[model samples]
Target chain A: MSDHQPSQKELPEAPSTAPTPAGISRRGFLKGAGITAAGTALLEGVQGFSREAVASTPKGVKEFGPEPFPVTLHINGKEHALQIEPRTTLADALRIQLNMTGTKVSCDRGVCSSCTVLLDRMPVNSCMTLAIDAVGHHVTTIEGISTDEQMHPLQAAFVRHDAMQCGFCTPGMVMSCVSLLEKNPHPTEADVRYAVSGNLCRCGTYPKVFAATLDAASQLARKA
Target chain B: MNSFTLADCSTVEAALSQLKDGAIVKAGGVDLLDRMKNGTDTPTRLVNIRNISTLRGIHSTPQGLTIGALTTLAEVADDPTIRTQYTLLADACGHAATPHIRNMATLGGNLLQQLQCWYYRSAEFQCLRKGKELCFAFSGLNQYHAIMDYGGCPSVAPSSGAVALLALDASVELTSAAKGKRIVTIRDFYLQPDANPHRFHVMAADELLTAIHIPKPAPGTRSAYQKYGEKESHDWAIADAGILLEMDSNLCRRAVVAMGAASPVVRRSHEAEAALTGKPITHETARAAGQASMTGAMPLSMNAYKVQLFPVAIYRTILLAAGQMDRDPSAAG
Candidate 1:
């Protein structure tokens, strides 16, 4: 995927009558409104919380937002510094702030693995993690799984096996498989199934996911 | 989720000092973030305790094992010593949520998680557990509600770690800035519905769960955990059992049977434990123990199936712990 922000013209227009708050751009408001053509962000938007500062605590505890604070996130082996609210989740920070939109946020809650990302090489739901909490940690998104020139072996295997149907779950599924193969280079069918168990595919492409993950394991083993 | 100040604390003292009214301690932020997102809890500040290195390991002493509260479920589930000795806790942690969740969720977060009732979880309903007047589960969709020991609330206990810890006779260390520290058994850790429907546990707003202490299981102890969910992956246990049996060859000398997703809180079945304490490990005895477990269980309207499920869960889990039978093929979930 290209590292470019989608233009305002590119976004589907669901002209909202609701008042857009200041400091939040129209594109940000529309995106936060969760208007998607493919019915992707149907459940909850990445920035679902109210942005208005309600209350403030004492100053001695080293507090950061109710207002935008300086936060430097190390995503995909690169450092990107941005000012974001403390309530902004890692998923929203990646998609809305840094425009690393490869990490999708279908269900902003932690139940769905659509926002799966690697924090210090461990797969976790980025939607549940605060962007500030990700400081001093190595964050890897689906875009960072492979080099610019080539796809990861797991990604290649997914393409070879046609592992996705609706394709919404492909990124998260690939990230989970990549995490599994990194830990266990040779995974069985059950192992692969368990690895991607959290990543739900509404189209039910689980069999292909299992097959692709195992195939990638063998391919990596051969390379080794 | 509301906008809150983030206090990133590196030391336990710093985390403890930051704790105040309306300030929440965040270990892994798995359950806390879920509660905040659901509008169940709105904290003015999140005291980040994840950076406290001293609160993130498992240590063994001469008497027992101590597990730091910040230790992830994945670490507890994969620990070699826990796998061999505390098999019940290992199995419970291993089968929780998912691989990704196990990697991110902490022991303290799972143990302190709120009920899984849809009414309480959703912001739309003002259920009794949330200090409201009515419990919608009493009249609404309650196919997965509690079938036993539900008073005013049919919401079931949702923690697998609590169930296993109760069976293992574990104690939790709660530390506070003002009150210092106090240790309480896992059985006494939870507050029953009758005690207080508003709060799940007795921990104060200013306190933090520091560590878990599990006394060494007696010699000849065998244990196992069995959980039955509607789905095999990433679902809470519909009915779960954790059994610890101290056996002398084939005769059961002592037993601790704790159940989850069956009651408002993870509870030990004294009747079931009494039935198995002196009996020989056999299918018939296991069935009798299972029967004893459901002595006073009163099911709600749609959850009568749980009445049938709990006994079978207890029966098969007992057999599993005693090495009398393999895992029931039909109860894979």
Candidate 2:
């Protein structure tokens, strides 16, 4: 099939009050937006803007900065205010600022769920989530899963089923399993596999991980 | 990742205002954060539009299904209405990325997400997609490159949502502070790299994708999506196909076939659709339609295997859509 190209000339004219696409080049627009090309040097000049400049900026205008600022992150039912750069990820903030080093940062990208955490009860890669973006949401890490130093049922099951080898992927594996069990207490083996498919264990402990998650589900059921 | 301000916008109007001056809109941040970490994207500021309530739900409209831009892939897949009405989309969403990614990745973001090309992602090679003169994949490793050459750039549009939406005949509602609001069909939204190497879609920088609308299919229409990947999990499709067929007493009334991963864009196979329309959907006819889908495929040097894989992907999806065959878990191979 022939590609359909929407004619630019046929597009309706923009409103006078609307922000015109006059001076903004496509390269310039894409460089700062969405999932376009990446090069840190493209935005290096933004670091020099002052707070006063930001204040004087238009209501809808953006202010760029690499400078550290104080922001509060509500994590695991507690709010911790810390000074961090806008680029600081939830994983980095938890590990470096608050000393909650339980959330591992292996790939540091979204691919590896080593830094898996619950952002408003949904599993998300903490390494890819910016600290500032997580401000209003509930952030639950591996360290927060337990209460009063007692291992969560999922964690206890992991130990029981020997769902660890090098133990690097355990924290993430446990967090993912906890989320699955919360949503589905009686998941099939296929459900368990689909739940933790994002969490990679180089140790090849998937069989044990599955066993532990199932056992934890049964345990939680009995307790209920 | 480079340092940038995070601008939190509470409304669509506010988000559009901040979308100017090298400010990128971020929702989910699955793809944006990954590109930032790879040093491929350096925005001066990130306009956080996640708080915009209007862009975060799924509703049925008189026209059809209207899905908010920020609706996650998991939500779309799990939505009972969508699962029953638009099974192709549900299957595509269920098979895309992984559970964690599906939870974080939004439908709008998935549609506009960048291709997962190794050279394009790597800082070492300044490929054409990055505004360079050359396409490194042409000379380097291109095993995952597009089989159909729609443009100079070899990277495929990696959205399963896009592939399924094409078969469903969906349209996107785009709103910009400048250009009030306009609806464009999914087929007209994409741009080949040859036409414009820099941008993937026709959306202006200031425009925001508000929602996706899938027109209600004709009665008795069934659809299915089949994706072929190297691995069972966490891998992009090597080639995928989505088939939508409207049956009239065991005879095909209307057929729409869309292919992805094999092409730079989610493409409709008009030849395949023509071959099946007004014909009985038997095993032989389905195979014939699948063969017709490969009319103009021009595989890259390393991706020649897709020539063999694309037809089977299309055939299986057609069978599944026609209720001729059960969904095989190992179809990706």
Candidate 3:
């Protein structure tokens, strides 16, 4: 392979114990250079802090994988037993492994709230959460919000208000609002906006989303 | 993300033990997941410390408040005591990122988050923070880069939580199986870019931040935080200010002023704090303090507007802490 990048010798030292896999990712290459800089940077003042940290002796501690692990996740009140890679995210577990495609994965980096889900009723980015991390928590997705074939109040209001244009951000937006309404049943316009602030709708349906959520709040209030 | 084995640690000791052998700690996994996805950090083993129940919660003591490292930003933001007493911290936590991120982002993790510089985050640009030779922000689009104490890298401190904690005079506790535990003031926790551009804070890779200790405020002390972004919501601060004032009626007996996103690390403006202390917080005094806050600022090619924005942010934050300002200063800016 003809490499245009600088030679490995020109790069900075890698962190002493950070294992370099056979395939050096772009970041890995840069990280090697960074560790070398850190070594020189810490030499003067932070030597005591950095060296001791890097020199810690490895004990017989439990470890799990550069491979797959069996994990049980509680999703929508049901237990799922599956073999998943340690690196697999909760969003992938739901969408790919279990075939629950309602949850979207727009920004895999958690910038957009397209993959928002409820973990123990608190809203979190499903793509940012590890599958094993959701083992004991209750995972709720857009599909699980509906009760017995009846649309959730928020979902019904979203449809009535035409809150979605392309509907890509709907699941995450709905999930974020669902959490808010569950806690604050009578949320104001500002509250609704704040609740869905994490959700990005490039389709420009924010005004409609606010209207749908406020309308759903009143509907839930009427039933109560 | 590179594959790794996940070890669900039930105890801090267990987590610390697993911290060795090319393993990394996972708190809220907000920042860690970003690095993993970017391929910047590829740990073969992940020490899942989220399950350590002992490492979660906020405890109030007669001396002050001791918050566990695992306490999420949402928990801190919603705590009634924190809201009523440490309103600066509450505002910083509440207004950070968004509701979803706040729920998963822990106070400790927020304090130690890596720089938000585009050149650093993107793998394509090997900025100095990532161990490369040059900071692209020096010659590239740096509208959001630091203006004060940037040193070698122009990356700004990304944590609003650290800004509040610095003004509140908080300290963090870091524990390692090898070295036990040590407490360092929040101001000292962060390292300037010149010291080590590669590391954001002083917590060694093996050390785990265990707790944040905040002393009880003296009577008559009030505080507030103001963050200004180009977009009103869900954006990093263009200039954020946290002000703490010990007031006797209208007179400011003492002051602590901290500014974030203006420098490589969250910095306390001794000049600004000196300007406010022993003076009544009025339009003149607040304006003077704001000016003092920017005494040594050096703006980059595309970020001179921040130099103007920060003074306004500091001015309003001081007034807000003293109950003289009603509307958000950020809104005006």
Candidate 4:
């Protein structure tokens, strides 16, 4: 499974390494030298940071690849046992297996926050996160937005301010907003914008999103 | 791209042991996996270390803040210790990538984060740094590459957090099962792509960034980190400045100036630091410091804009660190 375009390194010899002092570490160079450079370039154009490991080239699509290991995802205050292929994302486990589809998945690239979830109370793009690595952490998805019988103030404001259209980007936006508020309960408009820049809504509800966040801050402050 | 194995280690020491040879440690995977997704790294076996308790967190000691290898950027930015002791650091962390990215991107990962060059990202482009036939960015879309490369590789070091930490003079704890343990300065942890663009660090495959130690700021000191980008929301700096300055009777006794995305790593402008140190942090001194920072920029065709942008950033950042805007310079001394 290698891309054969050979744009980067036209290696006369396979890249290899042995232990050496003051030399390059010989590992983590995936070669699918056959994938068109255009495909990789397209993916790079629209992206954000993620912790998911990616192969340099696309592995053939296979149905139900056998589980690599049994990892537990602690999502929304519950531990779900999952036998996942190494490639299974934390967001997929949340939506597909746990049936808590509150965290939306679009673009599937790390760039879009549609799959944003809180890993140990911090926001991360879940589509790019592997389930195995999340085994021992607290992950709060959009499903985890409500606490007890009450919705988080941010959620209330998001709905009150009409912060969604198709609702796909809402979960990630809300999660990002809530994470920001967890630390900076009173964020400037600029802060709100910066916090949710990773998330995108085709509906372009950003102004409303910012308004909802500001509204949430005021309400949280009042409650305090 | 799909040929890889994921191996998990519960302890840093355990992760160090997983390496037979040619194994790369996966921390938060924010940077490494992004590179992999973009065709930069293809590992046969990845030794996972994010779950290692010893490798995450920020703790204060008499020496100063000790950031674990897996300590998330969010933790660094939000930690009260960092906020109080290292304001510039807090500011830089606050501005890193985005809030979502800050969650999983570790401090170690951020400093170790490789260059984000477009040519390097492409699987098809040939660049001189990847031992390629040519460096596309030399004449291509290098507006975001580097401004300095007197050496070999000319890719910009895509590290905002490192710029802040470099100002703080942080040190790294490198531990490998075979090499035991050793500490390296943050300045030493990074390399210019010209030196070797294929890998970012000299730390061994069996090694783990056990911890990063930042010494307490010097007495009577102030620091600031300011960056210029297309926009402040979630963008890499067009030009960035991190300054750690020590003052004596309102005179600039010393300063450390580091500029990022202008070089392979957060580059310290000793010339700039020397020009401002022990001076009265005057507008003239600040202007000279900025000039010093911008000097020695060997910008490629696409990034001359940074040469202009960085000088202004450095001047502004130094003044901010010197508390120039808020004070009467005549009364400051």
True contacts kept of each: 0.67, 0.59, 0.64, 0.27
TM-score of each candidate structure, all chains considered together:
0.90, 0.89, 0.87, 0.80
Candidate 4's displacement at residue A174, Å, is 1.8
| Candidate achieving the largest DockQ | 1
**What DockQ would candidate 2 receive versus the native complex?**
0.29
List the DockQ of the predictions in order.
0.39, 0.29, 0.27, 0.14
Clashing pairs in 2: A37-B40, A37-B41, A38-B39, A38-B40, A38-B41
Error of 1 at A129 (Å): 0.8
Task: Please give, as one word, the docking class of candidate 3.
Answer: acceptable
Per-model CA lDDT versus the true structure: 0.84, 0.83, 0.84, 0.73
Give the candidate order by descending TM-score.
1, 2, 3, 4
Query: What is the iRMSD in Å for candidate 2?
Result: 3.8
Tell me the tens digit of each residue's lDDT in model 2 across A1-224: 22232232322222324333686655335434532232243245344554554666556444435676777777776677777777888887887656576788898877769889999988988888888778778898887787554889999999999999999988998988899988899999988998888888888999999999999999899999
lDDT of 3 by residue, A1-224 (tens): 12233233322232445545766755456546754753453343232222233243344334454345576777776676776666678997876666566799998988789999999999999999988788778999987888545889899999999999999999999999999999999999988888888898999899999999999999989999
lDDT, model 1, position B104: 88
Ordered from best to worst DockQ, the candidate numbers read 1, 2, 3, 4
Residue A24 lDDT, candidate 3, scale 0-100: 70
Residue A114 displacement (Å), model 1 = 1.4
Off by over 4 Å in 2: A1-47, A57-65, B331-333
Model 3 ranges off by over 4 Å: A1-62, B327-333
Judging by TM-score against the true structure, name the best candidate. Answer: 1
- What DockQ would you assign to candidate 4? 0.14
The residue-by-residue lDDT of candidate 4 on A1-224, one tens digit each, is: 12122222211232456734645433322222312442353344234223243333122211122224455666666666656655456876665555565678886657678888888887888877877777778898766677546778888898899989988788889988998899898899978887887887789889999999999898889989
